[model samples]
Structure formats: C-alpha cells, structure tokens
Target: MWGPHLLLGVLVVYTFGRVRCQFQYPTETAGKQYQVPQPPTYKPPTNPAITGIPNINTVLVKPPPFLKLLVAVLYGYKINRRIKPTPPIKKCPEGWFRRDQRCYFFSDKKTSWYGAESLCRLKGGYLAIPDTEEENNFLKETSTSEEVRLQGAPIPHFSRWIGLRSLDGSTIQKIITNELLTFTDFVPGHLASRGLTSEPCVHMDYTSSFLWKVEKCHRGFLYICERHLHFEFKYIV
Candidate 1:
C-alpha cells in the first residue's frame, strides 16, 4: 500500500509543472496591434513652356497668286465701266452744200481767175477741182440755173472761170490742187481749132448750154470753191 500511494503523488506533480510552463511561454505575435493596408497617393504631370509660338490675332498670311490676279481684274473692270463713251459726228453747217463729205460754194459776183482763187482762199477753201463726170455735170447744171435766174440780164460775159489752166501751154492742170485734168468736156475739134496766139484758161459758157471752152485768164467771170466738211465728236459728262 505505501508504494502505490507514493507513485500516484509523483505523477500529479509532473502534470502540473508541464501546464504552468505552457501558460508562461511567448506567442509568434505577442503584444502587437493589427493594421489595415494603406492605398498609394496620386500626382498630375506638368507641361514645359515653349518660346517660339506665334499669336493667332497678330499673324498675317498672303493670298494665293490666282486669287490676287482675280481681285485685280475685277477692280480694273469696275474702273473701266465708269469711263464715258464718245459721241457720233454732226451734220454740215447752214448754207454749205454737203456732198460726199465735201462742201461747195458758188460766187454771186464776177471776178478774174486769179481774183477768184484769192477769194476762195480767204474763205478757207480753194478753186473747185472736178474729179468725175458727175462733178462736171453738177457745175454745168449750177451755171445754167444761175443764167436762167438772171433772165437775160445784160452782163459783160456769160461765162465762169474754172480751175483748169495750161501750165506750159501744153498739159492742162488744176491750179488750186495741182491735180491733172483727167476729165474734160471740150467741144469736138474746138481745142485743136483754137488759135495758138492766145493764152488759154478753162471756162464754162453759160450762153451755150455750159459747154467748156478755153479763154484768157485775165477775163472776168464768176467762180466756184470747194472744201472738206469738218467733223467733231461730242461727249457726255
């Protein structure tokens, strides 16, 4: 009995010592507080200043070549449209006979050939030069009319001095214009039959149907003068 009791007391003592040692030993996280994980902070990026940029309000750009030419043409056309146009020519003056851009005047008084030419020059004209048969007919008709108007009034002679004259007693030429007398109405055989002793100037015979005849330049007769009609243009303001 004493041995069994002694063994039982020794086993109880060993078990109590093991339990107290376990309570006193430190744990892996002993005396430390638990913490939540923290999030990362964010930062914005910065831009650097540039030195060579131009301002939009101050910038100037040239137009294209075609656009510039088009603008210039339009401006020129506008200016041209504002300019005035020229007017047409006017009619001849009063008392002047207008015939194919020319004017004719018949004298009302008798004068020598040289005197007649001087009168024509004073009036800014020359002795008439009949270039065509029609012109010659006109002169003849005018002379006939003048004689008929006279009603056989007595005069020194019934003839008119024409522009034709023999410069060297051979070739007949117009003294006023110096043009050759290409047209003539000399009576048949009258020029060749005239005696060579007398110097001759041309005349229109009013007494015998205005036939052309050679006469002395010193003889007094009525004359005709001719000149070009002047033209002028009128304009609007």
Candidate 2:
C-alpha cells in the first residue's frame, strides 16, 4: 500500500549499498604486488668507521701498532741508503815521521850546510826549522836517539848543522827563508863573543847541552828535513 515515489527511492538506496559491500576502496598496502627482499651486493670498504653486513668478497683489515712503526723504519733506511759516507783521510808518507801535523825526515849521512840544503830540497822538503821550544826539544832528543845511531853514526855525535847563519855576524838569519831568527837556543856569550872570520854558520853542539853555536860553513854534520803533511782519502767498502 506504499506510494510509487517512495518505493522507487527505496530501490535506489538498496542498489548503492550492495555495490559498496561487493568492492571496497583500495588500502595503503593493497594487493598490487609484493617484492621479495634481495641480498645486498659486495663492495670495497670506503670508510673504516662504517661496518657493513659480511659478504663473500668483503674483508675488513687494520694495521697493528708495530707494523706502522716497522714501515716508518724501512722508509728511513731507504732514504739513508741514497746518501754516501765520507772517505777516510790517509797518513804520513813512507820513511817520514808525523808530529803535530808536520812531516819530518832525519838524514843518516853528514854533509856541509850548503850540501845539506841541497839534499833536503832533493827530498822535496827544506832544512828543518825549529820555531817553538817543543819543536827544539824534539829535534834535540831525536838527534841523539838510537834511531839515528842505527844509521852507522857513532852515538853522541858532537854537533849537527842547522839552517841558521849570519853573514854580518850581528843579525842571525834563517839561511833558506832569509827571515830573521825569532827564536834562539844559543849558549850564553856564544854569539856575542864569536869572531866573524871563523864562524858564520850555526850548529847544535851536544857539548853545550844541545845549545846553538856558531861554526864554519864548510863543517859536515847530520841534518833534518821538514814539510807540511798532505792528507789523502781512500774509499772503503
């Protein structure tokens, strides 16, 4: 007994309800499709602080404290190998004695002052000149030593010629260098009382306790030669 308009409206409402129940609105996680989670591929470590899941090709390594120190030592040794060592210096020449950085050669034979000068020059040196008390005493001791006696000269030889001479008999001079005598070991009254005619050359007189005395230039006596020492270098393995 309902009106026709009301019946029509009821039918429309029923149709809308059935459509909504049959197909609902799509949700946030719908049945579109689900992908399986794949394993991560291996990669070289870029940062040591970051640790990743372990894989077949991945390995984490850290150097020990001693290993770093050993590497540093090896690097220093390699740098040192590039540098060369200094060569060693050589010593005195053959038949020459070294003293206070000077080389000396003692003669075995006796010769006049001029002859002695020539012989010393032939040996690449000049007649020995004593400049200090130490040097003077050294010459005195060596003159009477067994080293000189072994040269067939009698022990305690009376005198030995030196490089001193005075042409004017007033000013003493070194014969070869022509320099004025700065040091003298002359005996008292030796130079002041000596006559000019008989004495011009000087000699070391053992009788005067190895003091200097004026004598004739023609007298023969043993001599000494001196030269500066030259140091050399030799490479060693």
Candidate 3:
C-alpha cells in the first residue's frame, strides 16, 4: 500500500524538522560584563554631644607630689643659705710685705746708700730690714732658686749699694729710724752723677734675687721707690 510518493513525503518532513531546529533561539542569552558604582562612606562629627563624651579641661593639671616637695626643698636651701659660698682668700706677694693687702717694692736698680735712705724717707718706706726670724727666713728663701750665697753676685758683678751706710763713713752698718716713724729713716737712692768716692748707691734686682746691694752712686740703672699702700697714688706732672 505504501508507494514512492509516501516515502518522498516522509523524507520532506524529516528535512523540514532538522531545518527548524537549526533556526530556533537558545535558552541562555549572550552575556556582557559591566562595572557598577557603590554608595559613599559616612564620617562622624567632632562635637561632644554627637559622641556622648565630656570635654577635657587643659588648665588645671596637678604637679606630682614628689616634684612639689623637691622644688620646695631647693627653694628653702637657696633662701636660707644652708651651703654658704666661700669667699676668696687673699694671697700676699712673695718676698714682699703686705700693707693694706698690697705688695711694695723698695728698689729695683742701683741707688746710693745715703740716697737710698733719703729715697725711702721720701717714698714712705725704710731700708728693708728683716726685723723678725720670719722676715729673715723669707728673705733668705726668696733670695734664690739655687745656692744664693754660693753664686757670688753673678761673677762678672753688677756693683750696687744698699741702704746700709755709716755716718762717720767708715764701716758699713745697719741703722734704724729713731722713732715709730710713718716714713723711713731715709729714702730710696738712685745712681746719679756724683764724683765723690763716698757715693755708694743702693740697687735691687728681682730676677737676680739680689737685695739692695751697695755700689758706686754714679752707676746708671733703674731704681724703684716704695711707699705705703694706703698712700694716695698720683702723678706730680
């Protein structure tokens, strides 16, 4: 009963079914990637009411108890003078007498013996005489760093004179001012141009450690004259 026409019809139906299935839309749509923006984040306000907290008071900070005690202790010491500052000690000059806390130099260069006495009288000091053992000892010690007596006047010898003199002009002797004199028995002598053989002058050299030495008065050298420390210093000119 089924001939060629029925066979052709079945083939056409099968072909049509295949073609329709090929043209049908798929269940899943084609996907496209996209980027989206998020909402802004919030920030809290600075006011105390919003935060529900009390404000700090910066004015009234308390010092530590130990700190206060330490400060008080230091203040007490400063006010009370618990540790008093020591005053400086005054030192007198070596090989010199301290008069009113000052050192006086009688002579430095050659001066005549009598001239030296007169000079001392004028200046306000006497021919330095070591009155005490201490003075004599000080003189001896200050006279040299080495053997003073051993080194005999630097050998080549710078001749000078001392205040020691004789009224009779015979022997070199020590003399004193007659009274408790404010000024010397005499004055500091200088090497002036005196032709007289009796012109023995007094001289002093600090470095040589030679005290007033007696020499010819005519010698040319620098001389020093001492006066009381309390004496008002001035220039005659």
Candidate 4:
C-alpha cells in the first residue's frame, strides 16, 4: 500500500512541472508578430517640369542641324588643308611613251643597226629589248608604219631594228643582256629557212606581220630606244 501511494505522488509532480514550463514562454499570434512591408507612401514625379528638374533629353540638348553641318564642313576643310593631294603620278619625258615601268622613244629617222644602238647609248638607253610577250607586242604595235627606204631604193615593206642579233650566226641573244634568247616570237620557219650570213642582224618585218627576220647590219631601219622611267612627284597648289 505504501509503494502505490509513492508512485501516484511522483506522477502528479512530473505533470505539474511540464505545465509550469509551458506557461513560462509567451505565445505569438499568426501573421501579427512579423508584418509584411506596405507599398511606398510617395511616388516619383510624373511631370519633370512641375518638379523643377528637367528631363534627361532636355538637360542634354542636341546640336542644331545647321551647327552640325557647319562643324562637319569645318572638319573636312581642316583635313583637306592638312593633307595635301598626293603628288601626280610620274610621267615619261617629252616625245617618249610610257609602258609599265619603261619609257620608249621611237625614231623618226632610219639608221643602220650599229648606228641605232650607238645613238640609243648616247641618249642614255639601249636598243629596244622586249623580254616579255606584252613588251614585244607593244614594240610591234608602236613601230611606225611609214615606208622605210634604203639609199632611195623604194622598199615596199618597212621594218625596225630590234635588240636581237647572233654574233656567231648560231646563238641568238639580246645585246643588252648578252645572253641567249629565252623567249622568241619568230615566225614558224623564218629561222630554219633563212640562210646564215656574216654579221646578220634581226629586225621586226612588217611584211611578215611583225615577225622577226635576219638582215645585213649595214641596212638602215627605224629603231626604238628603251629606258627605265621613275616616279616624278609634282606638287599642286
């Protein structure tokens, strides 16, 4: 009977202790202890003029059309003044025709092969030497069509002495380079058909349609002189 009474007392004391612990802490109401933030009380001014502050565009004014045009014109004029026009492209001398980087002087008078070469040397150049097909074509096209006579002998065909000749009659070469010809535009059978003679020189035969032909060096013919042309700068005011 004592054990049962003691057990009942222990149980009653534990229950009272739990009740006191619960009452010591305060309780919080739902959604009241931490409130949600409300919207701002004052809104930004809708009319910037009424607020005494100008809009971004108004504060940063754009230049007028005429002012912009004037500024552009002035800038262009300044640039033009600073930058002078590039010097004019160089030109060949008087009575000389320019082609690529070379200047050519076609002779109006006929002379022998040696005479023509000497004259060309005196004039600061050499006999016309065509190293390319384009140059050869130019030479052919530029050659005068005027009749060429030998000692008042009325020759039906005209020709010009070029820079090609074979000293040994076996090895053709350019006098300027003193080397064997690397390029040849000879007529198909002209070389094979021609008989070799002493001191035979080459000429552009108009009768054979600008093909090359071997002839005696003493014979007179029109010739072309060639020289390198350089750029000449000319100033403009």
Per-residue alpha-carbon lDDT of model 3 for 3-121, expressed as tens digits?
A: 89899999999999999988734445325343355788787575766764534452235454445445544553453333232222354334444544334443444443444444544
Writing each residue's lDDT as its tens digit, candidate 1 over 53-148 gives 665554545554445445544553454344343222345445555578776777767876666665655555557777889988887887677667
Q: What does candidate 2's lDDT look like per residue over 80-154, in tens digits?
A: 344343222245558777788777777777766666665655555557888889988888887667244564656
Runs off by more than 4 Å, candidate 3: 1-96, 99-103, 132-134, 140-161, 175-214, 220-237
Candidate 3 vs 4: which has more lDDT: 4
TM-score of each: 0.54, 0.54, 0.29, 0.53
| lDDT-superior candidate, 1 or 3 | 1
Better of 2 and 3 by TM-score: 2
lDDT of 2 at 91: 55
Against the reference, the lDDT scores of all candidates come to: 0.66, 0.67, 0.42, 0.70
Ranking by TM-score: 1, 2, 4, 3
> What is the C-alpha local distance difference test score of candidate 4?
0.70
Once superposed on the true structure, which residue ranges of model 4 sit more than 4 Å away at CA? 1-90, 144-157, 231-237
Please provide, for model 4 over 1-237, each residue's C-alpha lDDT reduced to its tens digit, 9 standing for 90 to 100: 799999999999999999988763334644456556699799776775676564679545865544544554455345434433232235666888789878888877777776777666555566787888989988887764334324354544468888888877787888856788777888788777785456468888877777788877767688888777554322221
Among these predictions, the greatest lDDT belongs to 4
